[model samples]
Each structure stands twice: as structure tokens, then as C-alpha cells.
Target: MKKLLLFVIVFSVLSAATVTFWAHQPIIGMEEKPIEFSIKAGSGVRSSVEQIASAGVPVNPTLLGFLARLSGKSGRLKAGNYELKPGTTPLALIDQLARGEFAQEALVIIEGWTFRQMRQAVASHPALKHDTAALSDQELLAKINPQYGKPEGLFFPDTYLFAKGASDLQVYKQAHSLLQKRLNEAWGRRDPSLPYKSSYEALIMASIVEKETGQKSERNMIAAVFINRLKRGMLLQTDPTVIYGMGDAFKGNIRKRDLETDTPYNTYTRAGLPPTPIALPGAESLEAALNPAKTDALYFVSRGNGTSVFSSNLNDHNRAVNKYQR
Candidate 1:
């Protein structure tokens, strides 16, 4: 009976204090800087408050939990990582928890970046949980799905927003899913006469177009030049493919022998698409690959002003190349 009476008295004091003082009081241990904490999925009000307290955020867990229950917000508690900042009142904290406002982070995967570059960026991201950091490239692909044989050009380039502390794989999965959606949709709406044997081949063409198009507006023309080359049984002969084949050996320049060297990605030495994508391709590149411009042009020369000049024959291409490149 005394213990019950003591509990009622303490609860009464906290309730009265909340109206005038307690709810407005600043939480302890966050004056210097904000602290990040997490409430695990399925955690109740007491567990969440205690977890925050355990992370050195000194708040009256019992009183907060009691107030939450009294205010009919106990069942509304949402889980995820959160930030506890200085001057955060008890009422505001509860509201934050109730609204499921998780701390968010943005990661950008750039278009035309290699798979290795993408991996490096993801590995070095500070906000991610790094669950896939130790996984091998193939193993990482397997973690996403066993059907994935390679990682290159498989992920879409975009800004992804995820809850802070989310697994890095979440970003990967989101990108992969989005890329597949875009690729499949583009394939479905593709020009029927395109020379690609499959959607994957279109993806390879997209990667090539992404790399070779120096000007953003010339993607369709670049795709057409390559498509014309492919249809005529001529070499794709793209420099980026040769550089991709050279791997670390490329020193910011492509030599004659480098183009002559036989590798799966050396389009100068091989007649068909490379074994895998060489870089991530953006949606515009994919669209261009599926629907190249209708043109007789089989060659392109960069105009040195971030644009290209196309030619239907070798003589004109050589003249343009001499004017711009030589």
C-alpha cells in the first residue's frame, strides 16, 4: 500500500511539473553537440527512452514513458535512428518519436562512373552502416541476387535518400532495382530495328554511348554512329572500351598497342559487345541506345568544344578529326 501510494505521489508530481516546467526542460548530455541514437524496431516507449538514456542522453525515462502513455501516444512510437540535440524539450522529443522522422542521408552515384569507382565511393561513405564493405564484388552481387554475374553498369546513377544508419546495401539495392526498371521499360519501348540482341546488350550500348558522347545533347548521334558501325559489321572501335580493357595500365592516354591488344572490352579487337558493362549509364544514354538517330553516319569526331561532328564516310571523318584533333 505504501509503495502504491509512493508511485501515485511521484506520478502526480511529474504530471504537475510537466504542465509548467518538466516538459520544457532541456535534456542533459547534448549541450556540446548533437548525439545520434537509435530505437530498434518494435521497441516500446520505455525501451526507446532507456536506449536514448543509455547513449548518454539523460532524460527521465519513466516520466517520459508515463507522459507518452497519458497522452495516448505510446502505441504511436516509431523506430529508426534519431538525433538528440541541445535545447530539445521533452515534448518535442516525444513528438519527434511519434512522427517517425528518421534522420536521413543522401548518397549520389554519378553517371558514367566505373563499377570500381562506385564501390570506392560506397565503401568510403561515412553515413552508411558498411554491411557490404567486407564482401567481395561477386559476393556483393550475390547478396543482392544470385543471378547477377557482374556488378558493372548494373546500378542506376541518382541521388538516393535513406535513413541514417541504413545498410549500404540499401543504396545498392535501390539503385539496382531502379536500373532494372529503367532498362526493362526502355527495352519494351525500344525501336524494333535496333541491333541489340537483348536488353543487356542495349545496356552495354548505353554504357558506350554514355562514355563516348562528349556533349550531353549528342547522345543520340553518338549512339547512331556506333549502331551504324555494328550493323555494317565494322568494329565498334571505341576508345573507352580499350581503356576499360587496359584497366590500371591506362595512364590517361591510349596508345596504338593498347587499342591493338586483345581483351574482352577492347572493341577495336573484338566485333561484339564487351563481356560486361564498362561503366554506369544514365537514363538518357539508355534511351538513346534503344532509339538511335536515323542516320547514315558511321563515324564521329569530337569538335574540341564539348561537341562532335558526324560523317557518313571515312574521308570527312578524317578531315574533321584533323581539323579538331590534329
Candidate 2:
């Protein structure tokens, strides 16, 4: 009886060792490129193993199953798309699955993009489970947050990561939350003399500043120009606001007639900031709006490049327009 028991123990040990070695071997004929394999959610170990094998990986399902059961990993497999590359072993793949490491997908929201553009981006991502595509703008805003009457510039502009099958609402919620956090932090650190009545007003100004200049160094200066105009109760006379107010009616260019047209968002005609933000503002623009440079400059004009020329009086600004814009 003792001899028979010893034989059984030796055979079991050898069997486990052989299985471990088999699991560690690199799959043959796998090319030097990565291949994507998907395990459906709620898939069992057997089904998952079969799916991996179907992806041209030479894995022994039965032995893998036995090893998984023995190692107490039979029921711990996570389901998602995984990239199987050359030199990847069955053991490594199994370990990855057990740790629930699903592939992440990235979606980027560009700064200065309108909410309409942001919506288009979210609706176009293939990996996301979209729930807002069919909804109208108002309905979508209601779904995201009821307090928000419109969806123009509410979401923060940045790259967001999500697991496969994540809903569009989930992405929007994260962006909205991050925007709120950033806005609050910036508002708390703002210069006390800023003319903004609330954080929302600062966000509106930030959006204008974001759209007005592409140069990072000019942001504070541009903010200061707008601040000076606001303090003097003068017209902002910004062309971007006039373009925004025109909406789809705005052609490729702005004309004198367009600037003279009265609209709530037409800063050339209207007195104060627009009703809401015209585009998404980045962190730097937000900071610049809250902490404008101390300057007497009340106007700025693009120098036909990525930079702007600021002037303290109208004469210099008109001459700059003729020198650069002309």
C-alpha cells in the first residue's frame, strides 16, 4: 500500500510539472504582430480558453483548465478584448485575464471645440457604448445633468480613458466632474479684483480667450484687454463673439454688417459677456481669465501669425490692423 501511494504521488507531481512547462511555452507560428482577441462578458474558463485557441494560439484547453482549477483561478477570469502578441505565453495570458486587465480605449476632447464638436467626437468613438446619439441636444443635456440648461461648453477638454463598452454618459459625466473641480480650484485662486461675477462668467471669458489666441504667452494679456474693456463699460468688440452669435449663418468671414447685427452673443453690439461660453476652455485659459495681467491695454489684433499685438489706444490698434491684417 505504501509503495502504491508513493507511485501515485510521483505521477501527480510529474503531471503538474509537465502542465506548467506546457503553459509557459510560447505559442508557435504567431507572427511578430499583435492580434486582438475578445472574451465576451460572463464567459466561463472553458469558453474563454476555446476563444483564445480560436485566435490561432496553440493552447491545450483541457490542461489549461486543470491548471486553472488547481491554482484556484478557474472562476476569476475577466472578460474583455486583449491583445495577444508574439512571445506571449499561455501562463502570461491567463495571469493577465485573472488580474482583470482589460484593454483601455482613449477619447480626446480638444480645447476650443464647441459642445457640438464634443458631441460628434463622443458619438463617433467605436469602442464606447453610445446612449446619447439619438437624443436631442436638450434631452442629452437633461440626461447628463438637469441643472444645465444647455450643453455648449460644460465638459472639460482632455483625453479620457474608458474600458470597452463604457457608455457615452459615463464619459460625459467624468468630463463634467473634472470641469467642475478645475473651475472651483481656479475660482478660489483668482485675483480678487477680477470683474467676473461668478465662476461661470470666468468660464465664459476663458472660452473667449481660448478662441481669441493660439499663443500661450498672450493669454493673460488678452484676458487683461477684455478685463479693461469690461471695467470701462466699453464694448468688447470681439469678432469671435459675433461669429458665435451668427451660428450657422456665419460664413467663412465676418463683415461689417455681421458685426452690426444685434444678437445676445454679439459682443460688438452687446455690452457685457455672452449668456454662456462659446467653446471649451483649457486649464491655462481658465487660469489666465481668473488672473489677468495688470495692463492698460484695451485692444488686441492678430499679427497674421499665431501671436497678437496689443495696444493701449485705438490708434496703435488700427495701425497694427493695417500693418498686419492688411
- What C-alpha lDDT values do all the predictions have? 0.89, 0.88
Q: Give one clash count per candidate, in the order shown.
A: 0, 0
In the order shown, the candidates' Cα RMSDs to the true structure are 4.3, 2.3
RMSD to native, candidate 2: 2.3
Candidate with best lDDT? 1
Kindly report the root-mean-square deviation of model 1 from the true structure over all alpha carbons: 4.3
List model 2 lDDT by residue over 1-326, tens digit each: 99999999999999988988887887554666766778888889889888877876567877767767777888998888777768877777778789877668899999999999999999999999998889898898897788878887788999999877888999998998899899999999999998888899999999999999869999999999999999999989888888988999987999999988899999987898999999999999999999999999998888777988999999999999999999
Report model 2's TM-score to 2 decimal places. Answer: 0.90
- lDDT per residue (tens digit) for residues 19-119 in model 1: 54777777754546887888989898889889988877777788788767876889998999988778887777888889987877889999999989999
User: Best candidate per TM-score, number?
Assistant: 2
* Backbone clashes in model 1, listed as residue pairs: none
Q: Residue 150 CA error for candidate 1 (Å)?
A: 1.3
Q: Each candidate's TM vs. the true structure? A: 0.84, 0.90
